[model samples]
Target: MKALLGLFILMQIFIATNAQRVCGTEIYTQKLFAANPVIKNAWNNAEVQIASTTKAATGFAARDTAANEIIYIPLVIHIVYNKVIENISDAQIQSQLAALNNDYSYSNIDKINIPAAFASLAADTRIRFCLAQIDPQGKKTSGIVRKYTVKDYFSPEDGMKISAQGGDEAWDSKRYLNIWVCNMASRTLGYSSLPGGLANVDGVVIAYDVFGSGEHVRAPFNKGRTATHEIGHWLGLKHIWGDAICGTDLVEDTPTQQYYNYGSPTFPHVTNCSPNSNGDMFMNFMDFTNDGCMNMFTIGQKQRMRALFAKGNLRNSFLLSFACDSTLAQGSALPAVDTIAVLSNKPLPQNTGLKVYPNPTQAGVNIEYIGTLNNISKTVSIFNVVGNCVYTGKLTKEKAYVNMANLSKGIYIIQIKEGSNRLTAKIIKE
Candidate 1:
C-alpha cells in the first residue's frame, strides 16, 4: 500500500511539472507534410488565400462585417476508452461544449478577468458549436460515440483516429468537427490537424483528463480550455508565439510574444520581444497558459477563423450543412445535395394546439398536442438556445413526456413537425 501511494504521488508530480499544454499542431503538420507531399501544396494555397483576403480587408476602416455573421459548427465527439472512468459522462461532454461556445464567442464569464488594456481586442468570433443530431447515415444521435479499447493509451502517430487501430474513425471532416478523447500515451495532452490535411485524419485528439470541465477534468487544465485552444488551431489560429522565441502569429494587433507562457502570470506580463508594448497576450486562448488563466481570442484571430469559412474557402462547406435539421427524421437517406433552406414559417398558437406545461420543468414536462392526425409520423426535436437539437423523437400519441431532467438549466425550443403542419414552443429546464 505504501509503495502504491508513493507511485501515485510521483505521478502527480510528473503531471504538475510536465502538463503537456504544448499543442502538437506544428508537429503533426510537419509529419503530415512529409508523409503526403500533396498536403504542402494545399496548405500553401490556403495561406495565399488568407493573405489575399487580409490585403483586401487591410485597416479597420474597411471594418469587416465578418464578425457580424454567426456561424455554427457541428461537432461529434469520439470517446475511445480503456477504463470505465475514461468513458466520460454526457454532462461532462456538454460542459466542454458549453465552454467552447462561451469562450469562442467571448461570452466566458472570465472575460472580466482580462486586463482593461486588452479588453477591446477581445473578439466574439461569432462562432458557435453544437453536438451533431444527424449521423452520417441520416440517423438520430446523441453526438457522442464510445468504443472500449484494449489499448491503454494512444499516441499521435498511432492513428487514434483510425478504427482499425482501436480508435474511432472520423465522421465526414468537412461538415463536422471530430474530437477524439482517450488516454494519451506519455505526457501529451492533445493535438489537432490544421485546416488543410487529409480528410480522413483531419480533426482534433485530446486526452480525456483535459477534454472537459467538472467531474472528469483534472486540476490546472480543468477549465476545458485545452479543447478551445486546439480548436483554435483547427480553425486556422496559430500559437501567439508561433512556437518559437520572438515569433509571429501573423496577427496585427497582438503584441509579438517571445515564448509561450505557462501557469498564471501576473497581468502586464510583457516579453522581451515586445518591451515597448503591453507584454505578451498570455491570457489569449492561443497561448499555453493553464485553462483558468486563458480567456480571450484577439480580433485578428477572429478574422483568420472567419476567413477560413469564407465562400470558396476550405471550411465553407460546413456553413451549408443541414445535419441539425428536422429533415434528418424525414427520411432514411439524405438528399445527394445538401441544402440550408428554411424548414417552416407557420406560427404556433400560444398554449393552444400543443401545450408544454410547467414551463420551467425540473423533472420533466408533459407535451400535450391536440388536433393531430394518427399514424402520420409526428416528430419532436428540442433545440437549445444556440439551435443545437439535444433531444429528438416521435410523439406516440397526443401527449408525451419531454424529459428535461438530464438537460442543463436553460431555455430550449421544442419543435414538432408532422407532414405539412409544424408547431414550436419554448421550454425552460430548471
Candidate 2:
C-alpha cells in the first residue's frame, strides 16, 4: 500500500512539472509518430539520406557550390483567434519574422551573450525569412491570414491545422512556411510538425500571446524565440537533451545532456551527463529555457537542417518557390527591402547606444547617436513594411533627420550600420 501511494504521488509530481513546460513539440511529435507509423519511417529514411549525402563526395561538391549564398524562405502566417487580442497586429507578426531572420542568419544582437566555451560551436544557418509576397495561386498576399474561430482554445492534439476544426488550414507547406497563431490552452507556448509529417499540416502553431515581442505578448516568452525554436524542429533539429537522460541529440558538437534545462540556468551548467568543465549547452534553442536564455544552434545542428533542403528531400520543394519574387505583378507594391542587407558572412556588431526618436512621427524622425559615429563608413537605411530599403543616407552628424515626406502610412525599419555593426528601430508613419 505504501509503494502504491508513493507511486501515485510521484506521478502527480511529474504531471505538475510537465505542466510548467513551455514547449509541446516533443509530445506532439510522439503523438503524430504513433498515429502514423509511416511518418516515422519517412523520417528515418530522410535521416539515412542525409547521412549518405553528407558522407558522399557529391554532397561536398554541392555544399561548396551554394555555400556562399543566402537561402531565403517565404513564410505565411495564419492567425486563428476567438478573442480580439489573439488576432495579433501586422507589426507583431513582422517583428516575429524579423526575429527569426536575425537568429537564423546569426545577426541577432543578443548573440553576444553566448558564453566563450560554446561560442565557436555556434553557427549561421545562412537562412533568411521573408513574408510571402505571392500566394500559391500567384495572387498577392499580406502573408498574414486571419481567421475567426468559435473554439475557446486549442490543444496540440486538436486538428488546429484544419479549417473545419476551428482552425485555419495551412498554405502549401512545401512552398510556404505556415505558422498558426492562436491561444493554446495550458502552458504550451508552441508546437511544430517535423519535416516528415503530413504535408497539409507540416508547419508550426504558436500561442498568440507568445508569438511576438510587443503587444499581446507575455513576458519571458515574448522575444519571439518560441517560433524560432519550433522552426528548428520543423527544420529537423532535436531538443538539445534528446528528451532523455544522457541522451544524444544526434549532433556531434553538442554535449550530452541529462534533461531539459528550464528557466535561465547559469553558464557552464554541468549536469551528470556532461560532467566536464564546459558542461551542457543549456542555452541552445531546443532546450526548455525561457526566450531570453536561449541563443544558438550548433554547426552540427545547422548541417542537419540544411540537409533537408538537399535534392530529393521532403523540404527540397521550397527551393523552387517564387513566393518572394520581387518582380511578380500583384495587388499593391511590395514594401521596402530589409535594411542591413546580407552583405557578408561576418557577424553583426553589438548595438552602440544609437536611438531613433519621434518614432510615430508624421513629419520626420531624429537619429540620435550617443557617441562618436563619425569618422567611420556608416550609413542609415530605412526599410518599409515589406522589408525593402526605401532610403539610404550617410550619417555626417550626431543627430540626423530621416524625412518621411514621401513615405506611406505604415511601419518602417530604420537601420544604421558601421562595418559589421548594425542597429535597427521601427518607425510608424502616421
Clashing pairs in 2: 336-387, 336-388, 337-387, 337-388, 337-389, 338-387
Candidates' C-alpha lDDT: 0.75, 0.74
TM-score, structure 2 vs. true: 0.72
Q: Write the per-residue lDDT of candidate 2 for residues 7-45, one digit (tens) a residue.
A: 533443365443244677777776787799998898889
In candidate 1, position 136 carries an lDDT of 80
Error of 1 at 19 (Å): 3.5
| Model 1 agreement with the true structure over 284-345: per-residue lDDT tens digits | 99987899899999888888787788777778888886666645643332111100111123
Cα lDDT of candidate 1 equals: 0.75
**How accurate locally is residue 395 in candidate 2, as Cα lDDT from 0 to 100?**
80
